[model samples]
Target: MCEAVEKDLYAVLGASPSDSVQQLKYRYQKLALECHPDRLGDVCDSEAESGRRKFLEIDAAWKILSQELQQAWPIDSIVSLEDMTWDHDECVYTYCCRCGGQFIFSEEELPWRQGNDDEKKRNESQHMVVCCDTCSLSIYVKLSFV
Candidate 1:
């Protein structure tokens, strides 16, 4: 996977990582309104472009930060791949969530599922973060290809 250069989303919105979601939302809204392209009326072309770019960055930052915040609840559990139930029909491994939802992992989604035996050995002890499909709860799953 190609990783894009990561910008500090918190810094982009003049926020600290410790800020509450509400605070982040407030900061994002304030910055977004101030730099919105349409709000930057009658500015020179360069200034307009800069405003647009800033607005885009702020918008992107909010999107990522909001999702992370929503999923930031304490991890419900730490489970190993062997603890999950496998469904041959669906080709997925599932673990029941406290909310009656399920945390699903597919074979294709496993990094160690690909590559050579050496690569798989290196990834024998890997981790995957999965969220409950119907709730905010998440779990850390220890993965093994053995």
Candidate 2:
């Protein structure tokens, strides 16, 4: 797809920035089915070229939209301390937001919460659960106590 066309991926998918992922997916699927090359049923039809082109554009829009959705909402990924992704990185812990978002718990927060020192310093910390800012969902995370 051309760079100019890429800029309006949301518009191409019939989506607005405010639309939820589910809404965007639904719209994209509907448009995709409508423009699918095979949906024309006749390869020799005069509009076949146009329909094929439309399908390509729709497919490209979906690909771009899907990637954005995934990044914005990583969801509940259960990462362990051993993953090495979090090693000395800065943040204390990370957790999923019910709204398909993620929030990080900082190292600065560990000392402020009331907890058993031994538990905090052990191989694992208690599961600290919190609600998602975007929705009425809960997020759970554990600190690497070891």
TM-score of each: 0.49, 0.48
Tens-digit per-residue lDDT, 1-146, candidate 2? 65652358888887887665545666787898889988888677669998998889889888887776656643454444344234266754545554575455444344323234564344443444333446544334444553
C-alpha lDDT of residue 123 in model 2:
40
Runs in model 1 deviating more than 4 A are 1-71, 113-125
Q: RMSD for each model, in Å, please?
A: 13.0, 15.6
Per-candidate clash tally: 0, 0
Best by TM-score: 1
The number of clashing residue pairs in model 1 is 0
Candidate 2 Cα errors over 4 Å, as ranges: 1-6, 43-46, 76-146
Which ten residues in a row are the worst by lDDT in model 2? 107-116
For each candidate in the order shown, give its overall lDDT on alpha carbons: 0.80, 0.59
Among the numbered candidates, top lDDT falls to 1
The TM-score measured for candidate 2 stands at: 0.48
